[model samples]
Target: MQYKPLIMGILNVTPDSFSDGGQYCVQAEALAHAQRMVLEGADIIDIGGESTRPGSDPVSEGEQLARVIPVIQALRCHLPSNLLLSIDTTRSAVAEAAIVAGANVVNDVSAGTDDPRMFSVAARAGVPLVLMHMQGRPKNMQDNPGYRDVVEEVLTFLVERAEAAKDSGIRPENIIIDPGIGFGKRKEDNLRLIADLRRFVATGYKVLLGASRKKFMGAICGETRPVELMGATIATTVLGVSAGVSMFRVHDVKPNRQAADVTAAVLRT
Candidate 1:
């Protein structure tokens, strides 16, 4: 059977996210945007409360719960049951609350390093967990990001994190690994990771690519605004599908869906 990558739409309820910040901060607006993504073929809607953009400060756990819980609850009631909802946060408390409120997945950018209880929370809920490889905290991740071999280091980090998640009682099948595209990577580092995505895919776990509308794309295409990088993002999506990525976390769903479907068709043929 040919594998078609799943598209996970990004819905950030934060007011300071590098892209689409404050656009869906309101509960009604967030729900409407999520519905639109679902109609556009998003298999999962990832709702993030805190801004993890470079140099961005972390939102407190209480604020994160306030920002994301209502949105998750509303989504569960309104969205189709088959469509999954992911809680994008590093705090175990926030992950736990979002799960109870109806999110089916936990996406931790810190990969359970920042919060000692994160793995346990995901295990307790028995939900799929996305562990990402970020070099440092978002506050300073981009300050001096350096790597001897970006692809090797990230792959090692992700494999180790996956092992940690399994040891913490998270089912191996329920774990997904993300390369953390712009979280702490140089432009070249981001390119290398995408180019070498097969290495990550070969780890025998699901691989997620989250390179949608990042600063590095803008750097590559000479576009300053995040929204203008959709074309660049689509290119990466095509590459990801060819590289056997299991999923894509993207801001624009429809175009990526079309791209992935076409890529999968070609691969099948």
Candidate 2:
């Protein structure tokens, strides 16, 4: 089946990430998890070295590189050509090294604010760049994020960032925008973003919905563990696909792939 909403399996190589941290921090473990995701129908593998969970400290460049590059190299050598590899980072240096090591995309939660060189690296490599909107730096993003109108603000920020990336020599077609459901949003804001995802989709850029196992689900469902949120995650995947989202960044690939396939089938009729 042609995956309608491309499933980007999340592979956090950091030991302190919010979910599944330490579960795949070792090089061998990370590579094995990536291989499992690919076999489970993941179209893209997003590898991140640092923990972007709220209030997380930044990892040094050298450490981050050491964490992700080897796993990327191993996966690139092992996975088929069709499975895209994405380096989930905000640093330009990491993005460059990951691309050279065989990553096909740069998924930046900072949208280039963290590193000016990121745009040039992506442009030079000619790979797709995922620019996400975050109200503030991850360290203090969730510290009472406030907005007059969350959806409109997020949309405006993404449009401006997309244009800025285009102005910086990046191809328009190579840009993808994410509304950042939980990056700096409150529980209500995340719900609103998913409910009105069509506004982002209407921009004509490929919309990537990444509401996988976020804290908002726990707020709504009263579930504490990230793995327990799989049902909620699949629900959002189906909702995003119906709203025209082109991709989904998720932890559980098989369930999300199944959700996307069923949603695509329903929409085709």
Candidate 3:
């Protein structure tokens, strides 16, 4: 099979996300952005209602539902039936509601740690579950993230969570793991994770890289604005493709999709 990585377009419908916050908060805007991404070759659309930016406060489940469910419903009806919709939420209730509202995947950044019922909800829905490795709550995750070995620690954490999900009845093949770049990681830590992504890939579960326009990219490339980091993001996507990453969750779909495709083509040759 060709090694083309899946491109997961990010659609954060919150007023406070780090990047593109409030850009698609309205139903019409969200729908339009999603359509554009789909046209740009997004294999999946990850819709997030809450802002998980560093030092951000959590949104209530009711508020989250209000923000994301209608968007999911609209996207479900408007987009192709085969295009997967992923609800990026940590709360099981919100995940369940999104699933009922038409989402096909559960992307929990906390990896079933924030809500104990998350795995059960994914299992019940029989949807693919994304279990990410976040060191702490978004409010204080970046306060001072420390790890003896960033890659090994995150890898171990994700593996244990995957096992827990399997123990809770979630099928093994449906589980995907994310390293949670920038969520609770320092610049060096984030770089290390991206560089050593193959370790996570070696774990056998599909590995997702969400390093889209992250702060560390800015710190390295000297671009403070998130939107300006599309090139940097594409660089990471290409690096991720070479590292055997299966999926890329990104804000800019077209460029990263092109980069992944080109890189995969070159690698195959």
Whole-model alpha-carbon lDDT for candidate 1: 0.94
Candidates in order have lDDT scores of: 0.94, 0.93, 0.94
Better of 2 and 3 by lDDT: 3
For model 1, residues 123-242, the per-residue Cα lDDT tens digits are 989999999999889999999999999999999999999999999999999999999999889999999999999999999999999999999889878899999899999999999999
Q: What TM-score quantifies how close candidate 1 is to the native fold?
A: 0.99
Q: Lowest lDDT 10-mer window, candidate 3? A: 1-10
Ten consecutive residues with minimal summed lDDT in candidate 2? 1-10
lDDT of 3 by residue, 1-269 (tens): 77779999999999989989999999999999999999999999999999999999999999999999999999999999999999999999999999998999999999999999998999998999999999889999999899999998999999999999999999988999999999889999999998999999998999899999999989988889998999999999999999999999999999999999999999998
Models sorted by lDDT, best on top: 1, 3, 2
Show where candidate 1 strays beyond 4 Å. Answer: none
The runs of at least 3 residues in candidate 3 whose Cα sits more than 4 Å from the true structure, single-residue gaps closed, are none
**TM-score quality measure for candidate 2:** 0.98
* Candidate 1 vs candidate 2, lDDT winner: 1
TM-score of each: 0.99, 0.98, 0.98
Worst 10 residues of 1 by lDDT: 1-10
